[model samples]
Target: MLRRRGRLPAAPWLVAVTLSALLLAAARPAVGAAAWCIARSGASEKALQSALDYACGPAGGADCAPIQASGLCYLPNTLAAHASYAFNSIFQRSRAAPGACDFAGTATVTLTDPSQLWIMHLPFISKHCRAIRNTRLSILHSELHV
Candidate 1:
């Protein structure tokens, strides 16, 4: 292969990829402004249950009715799902206070929208999906106005 004096074949695509990655990174919210809280993966179900209880209880005071039987988010019916919902609820309620997302290390804060994750995984035509869509829209509206 003969090298051109002033041109590199790979340089153009490399530059384009670098710029695309940078733009995507810049479009996301800052690390310090994580907007959702969820149960950390690898966290024990027991710990999640405890955190869920605390969040829905008086101390954490998260609105947890949505995870109740027949409630909008009741499907999935797993510890992690319910805990994530409760964690995010309290986190949002407290305006993302310094320690609000800790949950004794069982929870983590992230910029990703947890509701959107749920919506994507569930069947699009399911009743649960519609409920979550409505809920997510309302949450987004509140966030925008705030």
Candidate 2:
């Protein structure tokens, strides 16, 4: 006689997926994992726009390709949003220097991962975002200066 096997129930699978997502959401940054960027609040629109131009252009020395129109970070287009991306790129590339994120008093550093808010919606770029954050954190821990 042959025996038949039953398939697992969908409820359990759903529960497991939910739990996994929660765990990932709660994941903490590695020790000394901090990053800096321009703050979207408290700055005048004109100042933010000027800073964005400088950051994406020459002064800040960051690649603003991703924040350009038709780019992954271009959605919900706003001066502050685009500026934040550009400022973060400069901050990460400049090794989080003391003033790299300042943008003339418009920026600040935070322990929380900015990518969590910025790139979370981009499934294709999520992994790349984590990689960039992780690399920056690791570099931050190793490099005593800045």
Candidate 3:
């Protein structure tokens, strides 16, 4: 009997295995960008920071206290006016999967110079609710590939 030759001779399995790995390796983000988040909220960057701390995690201790009548609960007193219009780069929690960053809860934002920048001014409230609609704050995600 003559030697048999299959229509597909070489192994297609090897080709598939190689491609999957290359795709996954390239999918990860840079070490630096992956380390932390660059958040922009309120006018001063500090306000957003305080908000992150208030999340009540051990990682950032000072932020773990009960909201105080003194303005510690939300943006501080000095920053109130500008708070509605400011978005400063703050916290960093991976937004893709197991890690994520989001507004503490339902927030309300009002646009100050709605005409100029069209950027809204965020407001402080005791509680966050879904019915609330804010112009300044929003949920956004960048689909940039690694």
Candidate 4:
């Protein structure tokens, strides 16, 4: 080991490296803390519909094509289902920015996998699961692998 009589030259570099590491860690999501946004359970249908409209509207700019009449996610045909999808879409598009999932308090964030929970709630999952469109599933699969 080499010792310097005066101040060490590496002090600045060490500080910079420490700061860079802290910044990168702060920018990243917490380990094993996968998060998703969903419509709040027990919210009135009217409220859910309103939030859904906002989520699908220009203000929210969420991809709502999946919830249309002929869309893959239309089967459930419930306000909660539609709202959940819309809320999550906008939440994700916003990169989960603060208040992105609020929807006037009709929406919330969850650590649970909302997509899986939604699928489980579908009545026809056992019989018609294959018939449902897999666009979202495929996208999720791609993302997980990446």
Superposed on all Cα atoms, model 3 deviates from the true structure by an RMSD in Å of 16.0
C-alpha lDDT score of every prediction, in listed order: 0.76, 0.67, 0.34, 0.73
Off by over 4 Å in 3: 1-10, 29-34, 40-59, 62-146
**lDDT, model 3, position 140:** 22
Candidate 2, which segments miss by more than 4 Å at Cα?
1-31, 117-146
Q: 2, model 1: CA deviation in Å?
A: 42
lDDT (tens digit, per residue) of candidate 1 on 101-143: 8898999877765556754332222456567869888999999
Candidate 3, 16-115: lDDT as tens digits: 7789988986666544443222233343456554545444335433222223333223433334322221221123222323233343421232222222
For every candidate in turn, the CA RMSD to the true structure comes to 9.6, 15.3, 16.0, 10.3
Candidate closest to the true structure, highest lDDT: 1
Ranking, lDDT, top scorer first? 1, 4, 2, 3
**Model 3 TM-score on a 0 to 1 scale:** 0.27
Q: What digit string (tens of lDDT, one per residue) describes model 2 on residues 21-140?
A: 889866743455676565557888888888878888876677877666656556547676677777888888877766677887776666655556654333212456456557877898
Give every collision pair in model 2. none
lDDT score for candidate 3 against the true structure: 0.34
Best-to-worst TM-score order: 4, 1, 2, 3
